[model samples]
Target: MMQTVQKRRTAGFLLVISGASLWGIGGTVSQYIFEIHHLPVEWLVAVRLLLSGLLLLTISLMLGNKEKVTGIWKQKKSAGAVVIFGLFGMLAVQYTYMASIESGNAAVATLLQYLAPVFILAYLLAVRHTYWNMRDAGAVLMGLAGTFLLLTNGELAGLSVPTEAVVWGLLSGVALAFYTLYAGPLLAAWGSMNVIGWAMTVGGAAVSFLHAPWNAAWGSWTWSMAGSVIFVVIFGTMIAFWFYLESLKYLKPQETSILGCLEPLAAILASVWWLHVPFGLYQSVGTCLILGMVIYLSLPQKQRAKPAPA
Candidate 1:
């Protein structure tokens, strides 16, 4: 039994790492599609959401679990939170990330977006008033401070960054935090598939409106565009998310999230290899610090014991 448990945990860790790596590659891949294909950010995101959501929905139907849709809708309150999470968390984050990249560099945007875990820890402790011991608090602070060091080029004073890009990146962090927290309760009641499907559907619809897909130049679809779309749909969105959900089955949420800290590092590597972007020394140090904090945060808390009778 212990061996089986260990094997499951190891598999879960691998799944989470794989998922994070895929997600990391997304920025570089999307940037390539946009630049090479001359596609609009809104249009690209719209297509991604529509295609990915449809594929997941089809898979769910094939599995004879179409009932999750109606079941999710029946719980109107729960559905609302799911919508918020998918819209602001998923859709909005995508938008902000694209905007940040366009307005600044992928490196900066990626680092800023990774601050999501910090925001999540803070929200849990400060707003929700959750019981976070000293270690947890310290972990959060270290992670956030490291992220700051990474983004600001290791400068503690007088940082001159683009305001618009910073705003978008910060917004992405907030959305990510909200999604993580909100998904927990909603998933507990509605299950991951139902909640994720509904959330994706609603979020996709909202993005469709923003992009006005009907007005897009569909004639621009070439072999390259088709290939890019297929890659994004299959590997980036579908497979990555599947791995993420699977990992959760065997790993604790914090443990999985800590492993997710690899995402930015993966993104940096992808950017360098695929896009020929340079990774700065400051960013590398910051990435290590962020990873350290994640590990710290993921450590299991020591439990107080009851006294035994003599």
Candidate 2:
């Protein structure tokens, strides 16, 4: 039994890492589509959410608890919660992150969005009345230092990217924090697929007007662009979400959050390699510091660690 449990935990960790890595690659691909193919941000977001949502929902119907899918709207509170999550959590995170990527490169956008942990920490302090500790302080300081170095490139003044990119990236962080906090109760009540699938559908429907994907210039679709779009929808959106959520069964929420930092690392590498995004020494140092914080926080607490055999 112990061996079986350990195996499941290891598998879950790998699954979470794979999901995060895929998401990072997808972000870089999205940037490519935006810069080279000139794909409109709104249309990409719309199609990704809509198509991915449908695929997930179909899978849920096929394999998951069909009762959850059908009875999702039976309860007024759950129905309302799903709508709110879809509109504020899903829509905001997706749109703001994409906007940041459009305004800047995937590296900067993803790194900036990684500040979600800081925001979440602050929220816990305020709402949950949690006590401030050395760990929290260290994490906040590292996050601030990382953002400063990444944005200014160690310059005395001004940002490396446009002011708009900074704003969008910061907004993406806020949206991510909101999504993380908001989805907890919902996930506990409904399974990952059911909740995420419905949330995506709601968010997509809400944003359908802006993109108007039906009226998009389909004539511009090339083989490369089509491949990128399909990969983003399938691997990035659907598989990524599914794997990450499945990991929650074998790992604590905090552990999964730490593992999710893999996304930023992958994004930064992909942007530097593929997009030729200029990454400075200061940015590299900042990335290391932020990653250090992630590792520190992810360490098992003394009380939680098991004793070795005597």
Candidate 3:
């Protein structure tokens, strides 16, 4: 039994890592679209969300999963939560993150977004009234310290970051935290595909309404743009998220969260290689520390009581 559990845990960690890696690719891809194509951030976001949502919806329908949507509206509370997740969590986070990236460097924006774990810990403690252990507290401190290092390029004294970028980055973290926290319960009630698909649909609708995608310059659409959109929808959103949900069945939430730390690192590397973004020595050191903390905090604690003989 113990061996089986360990194997499952290992598999889950791998899946989560894979998902993080795909997500990391998005930063570089989005940067390419933004810089090379000179596309407006809002318009890009609007198109990505709209197309991704439609693709997800089509898949769900083909799989005959209409029950997930129908049952969602029947339960008022769940429906409300889904709406909130779509609006405040998905939509808001994506917008803030895009804005942050546009206003500042990708590395800076990514480092700030990684603060989501801190927000998650705080939300668990305050809102859920969950007690924190020494491990949790240590992890939070380490993460924050690591974030400071990564953002300030190891020299905390010579930091000269912009205020607006910082604000947007922080907002992105908060929104992501809400999304992660809300996801577990919602997924438990409605499967991952359903929750993600519906949330994307609603969030896409919201963004479209806000940005008015119809007024954008759709005339400049090229094969590269279409390819990026296809990749984001299929690999980034659908397949990656599906893997993530499967991994959840095998690992504990904390364990999965710890593996998710790979996301920022992946993003950093992608930015460095694909976008030619340089990472200072300080940032490298800070990122290593943060990744270490995530792994430590995610380890399972041994029970005080001895196990009974088989």
All candidates: TM-score: 0.85, 0.92, 0.84
**lDDT score, candidate 2, position 195:** 93
* Runs in model 2 lying further than 4 Å from the true structure: 1-3, 298-310
Q: lDDT at 237 for candidate 3?
A: 60
lDDT of 1 by residue, 1-310 (tens): 9999999999999999998888777766776776677677787777677667777667777878867756776777866787787787778877888777666556567777777777877776575455566776777777777767666767667343567877887887787777776677887876676666667667778888777656666687788777776787678777777788889999998888788777777777887887887656776777777778767757776763434436
lDDT of 2 by residue, 1-310 (tens): 9999999999999999999999999999999999999988888888899888888889989895889987879999999999999999998999999999999989888888888878888987786446567877988899899888888889977788878888999999999899988898988888889999999988888888897768677887899999999998899888999899889989887889789989989999998998899999998888877777666767765442323437
Worst 10 residues of 2 by lDDT: 300-309
Pairs of colliding residues, candidate 1? none
Ranking by lDDT: 2, 3, 1
Model number with the top lDDT: 2
Candidate 2 overall lDDT versus native: 0.87
- How well does candidate 1 score on lDDT at residue 236? 76
Please report, in order, the local distance difference test score of every candidate based on alpha carbons.
0.74, 0.87, 0.76
What is the full ranking by TM-score, best candidate first?
A: 2, 1, 3
